[model samples]
Target chain A: MLRRIFALMLKEFLALLKDKRSRFVLIIPPLVQLMVFGYAATFDLKHVTYAVFNEDKGSISRDMIAAFHGSPSFQEMPQIERNEQIAVMLDRKTVQMIIHVGPRFTADMLSGRPAPIQIMVDGRNSNTALLIVNYAQDIVNRFNNDWVAGNGGAPPAHIVTRAWFNPNLESRWFFLPGIVGLLTLLVTILVTALSVAREREQGTFDQLLVTPLHPAEILIGKALPGFLIGIGEASLIVMVTVFWFKVPLLGSLLTLYTGVLLFLLSAVGIGLMISSLAVTQQQGMLGAFFFMVPAIILSGFATPIRNMPALVQDLTLLNPMRYFLVVLRGVFLEGTPFHLLIPQFWPLAVIGVVTLAIAGWLFRHRLY
Target chain B: MNNAQMRLLGLIRKEFLQIVRDPSSIAIAFLMPVVLLLLFGYGVSLDSEHVPLGLVVEQPDADTASFTASFGNSRYFSSVPFRNTPEAVDAMMAGRINAVIVLRQDFARRLRQTDGAPIQLVVNGVDANTARIVEGYVTGAWGKWLEHTALQQGQTLNTPVEIVNRVWYNEELESRNFLVPGLIAVIMTLIGALLTAMVMAREWERGTMEALMVTPLAMREVILGKLIPYFILGMGGLALSVAMALWLFHVPLRGSVWLLFATSALFLLTALGMGLLISTVARSQFIAGQLAIITTFLPAFLLSGFIFDINSMPPFVQAITHVIAARYYVAILQTIFLVGNEWSVILPNALALVLLATLFLGLTRLKARKRLE
Candidate 1:
């Protein structure tokens, strides 16, 4: 049985890696994706275009616009005149925000009254709008404090906030760790899900069924190749993340690998189950995607799980990718110890056992 | 009808029958949009609310009580009180709280004597976006407390720059308002590409291409026959997603429905042409599917300005997104759904779609002619 499984693993490797195009598919896309997504997937705002309509030509208003000009986060578009240009600028997608200072701006501040400055934000992309508002708020808050200090006294209270793990709050530190899990999922699911269905479509499954191999042996042979590929893919991504991307690995390599192995088990089990159910390679491809898309979205890789609705949040408890994401981010960012990660590890183990058992049973039943 | 038209009609009917007979194709065509729309609508949200925070007040004086009350009163924070800083830090490490607020021993003394009293905020910066949001909310809460205290003393606090924010297009600033439209682009790309990407490859793998080459059918008739069925299926997918976006998810359709349908048609042709082009090149279903995903779906998802802002990306990556059809479609969808008929935005994107469709279909025609020769 051991020899048979080894032979099957060899065959699977040759099938995936023998052809020049298939070899290229296996090696190059992940690297390209890593570089492409590393730069593209960011929430940090830069070169954000804003048009200023300073109705109050006072130094304070001018100072406010000057502050935006000095900051790297914003770019000032060519100044606009008519009230109509505000709508036109926003509609043209040329500007993300329109800063309009009211007429009573400086007088209200000098007389110690609340002066209103209307900021028309392009809310088409609400995340960018939120960040822009925060930037504007920070600039205004600083100006207010300086003015008050010049007059008589500063504010009596202020919060000195500091981010713990990521000081500058670089988005790269957050997303690169998550990319390790995503790339692993893409490779593992494709490798395992297509194995059995491809054999069936090519009329080789019947010959395999007539062999002396037991169902458990067949399952191991089918799953081991994908398992090794997933581990290799994960290791490559981790190396690139640490050395190339310069994200520090604070945790034990053992802890990270343990989590990855368990994750691969569950991921490979899912692929095998889809393979067992599919009659054709196309069906298997679609089935794999049907499961993979929702898994990634609900996993808190890009969007936070807490932001999901309650029922969907509860539904995420069953998703292996969700637990793996927590493990991946925690192990990379927080240096979380193994004992602290047991809760996540056990659920992944449970999913792996259940899915593998189901796939084994279905393979046996179909063969009989 | 002429014999060529009759042959084309027969081929389209046969493709339709094959699509209906295959459960996976039907599922990909009909069920995928529902799953993706609901998933995107409910699952993906940028609104960060009800963040859990830990509060450590060393001295519980009147000022401390009021200061803590501001965090507790606001809808954004759910503040839990801890006796000391150690306990709060433990909770933060265990992931129970995203941030901790520590009030020092001289809390009230500094408020009365010093010009600026210091309060410390330590945030879990694992998720940087959330941490930034927490900082912003904390500042807002602090400012409100100061304002409330000044009003009580009957002394007007001068805030020189008061911001009155007006969020246009989506006044409430819901993420779904734009996310729902972006979801349409993603769904169309997957369904169109995954569906037709395998058709020509499957024929080759099954040796039916050799059989079909022996017949009198023209290459143009075959390509058109393959595209017409999936085009209808892709259109059906668009209609389903748009209806769900409008009625189920409550996303406003501010532009003309006919125009939305027209742009969707153009985008679908481009997507289908890309898929058919990939199928013609790959010659096997496995490679075709992999190529479709690598070339079509991943680029559409990452580079299309769907979730991430394209302008924020590096310049080289930004240049790459120019060739992606979904970027234009997403721009068109967001404008049509959120902002009403803004031809300045819609016309440029629609023209790009037209150009991409022409390029892709023209490449596919050239490839098909070579295969026939």
Candidate 2:
């Protein structure tokens, strides 16, 4: 039975690897996506187009606008003459922020009075808009401190901000670990979901069932190829991320691979269950996609899980991607020890065992 | 009825029959919308709240206690006290805390001598966006603390400059206000492109395409037959999603629903055409499905300004997003839902949608010729 399952697994590999498109599907997409999404998934605001409406025309206002120009974050657009131009710039999205200096700007500042400078941010993308406002705030705060220090007054509160793990806070470092989990789920689920359904559609399942192989053997045969491909795909993405993308991998390789294999088992098991329930390849594919979309969304890949409603957060415990994301991020970013990651592993293990047992039961039931 | 019209009606009827027989497509068309709507509307949020923090105060004093109390009292942070920086760092590494606030031993003396008391904030920047948000929240908390302390001291240190920050369109700054509207484009893209791509490919995989090709039906009839059902399904999805956004999620529908429907129809045309084009290009089910996902779904999710800011992206990538149909749809959705019928915003995005719809449908019509290659 073992030998027969091995032979069946070999045949599955041959069919998958023999097709050039499948080979490309397994390799090229992950690498291409890694490069494309790596650069695209940035939260770091760089070279934000900004326009200045400095009505003051004082040396101080010019000096303030010069501060924005000196900073790398803002690219000063052509100065807007009227308030309406600021509105037009925002409406056309030509500028993300407009620094509007009122007519009394420098007069009040030199006379020790409160100068109200309006920073009109196009809040279409509120997150970015908020960050741009923060950047502008930092510049203004520096100018205020300079004014105070020159006048021999004490600074308000000194905030010494340091970001641990990712000092520069590069978003690529965060997303790379996540891609390992996401791409693994995508590949493993697609491979396994397409496996049994493909055989049944091609009229090969019956011939294989007529062999001396047990239902358990067929299940193993169907699952091993996807599990192996998932790991292989995961490793390639990991190498690209660690080497090509230069994301630091602080955890031991053994721990990362162990976590990946366990995650793959659960992903493959879910795929097998999807395949067993599907009557055709199309059904299998759609079912896999149906499961995948929600899984990724709820996994906290792009959004924080704690931000979710409590009931939905509870529901995420059942998702393997959710566990794997924590493990991958922990291992890659935090160098979380093997023992520390045991909590994440157990849920995946439980999910794997339950899904595989169910899949096996369904295969036996179908055969009978 | 005319003979041609009768044949087209029969074709559409057959398509619907096929849809009913295959539970997967209908299940996906209907079930996906509800599942995704709930997940996106309720489960997914960019709002950073309830962030865990490790508060390490070395040689704590009354002033330090009062300062740390502000962090504990704030709704944004839940603080866990630690003895020193090492212990807090350990907690941060273990993922027990998102950030660490350290008040040095001389913090009280520095505050007493001058207003220049230094506090160190160490944030675990694994999630860059989360880290940035935490930093902002912590700063706001510190500023509030400073203000309270000044009030107690009877000293109002007036600043030379004050900023009146007004976030336009979204007053309360709810991330959902934008996210839910943007999600409409993603849903329409998935249902229109990814779902329709598979149906045509499944026909080829099942050898039904050959049978249909041998019939007297025109290619236009066959294409329309495939396009019409999914178009209706996509519309149904849009209506259900918009309703969920407005009623369930309580996201305000500020624009005209009829205008939204009209623009959605145009976007759906482009999405459906992209689907038909993929299915025709890749005859096999597996390749077609993969193609649809890589081409439509990923682009819609990533490049379409669904979540990430497109203007923040590199210029080359920004250029790439211009061709993605969902980009235009997302722009239209955001304007209609948030900005409410601003023609300056709506007109350009609408014109782009029209152009993209024409381009995709024209390409699909060309590729979907009757002759089998």
Candidate 1 residue lDDT tens string, A1-368: 79998887888889888878777876799888988888888888788889988788677778777888998888889987778899989988989989988777877777778888888888787777777788788777777777777887677888898898788888778888888888888888868887888888897877877899888888899899889988888999999999998887888898899999999999999999988888888898898888888888888877888878899999999899999988888888889999999999999999998999898888757551
Question: Candidate 2, chain A: TM-score?
Answer: 0.94
lDDT, residue A278, model 1: 82
Q: Which ranges in model 1 have alpha carbons more than 4 Å from their true place?
A: B369-373
Residues forming the 10-long window of minimal summed lDDT in candidate 2 chain B? B289-298
lDDT of 2 by residue, B91-159 (tens): 888777898989998887887666678889999999987887777777767766876777788976556
Question: For residues A1-368, could you state the per-residue lDDT of candidate 2 as single tens digits?
Answer: 78899999999999778878878877788677767777777777778898988889688888877888999878889989987787678867778888889999989888877799998887666666777777788788777667777788765567899997899988878877887787788778768887777777777877987999888888889889998888888988898888888899999988898899899989989999988877677777777777888898889888889889999999999999999999898889878889989999999999998998898777646551
Leading candidate by DockQ: 1
Q: Give the docking tier of candidate 2.
A: medium
TM-score of 1: 0.97
Model 2 has a DockQ score of: 0.61
| Retained true contacts (fraction), each candidate | 0.79, 0.69
Chain A only: list TM-scores of all candidates. 0.96, 0.94
- Whole-model Cα lDDT of every candidate shown, in order: 0.85, 0.82
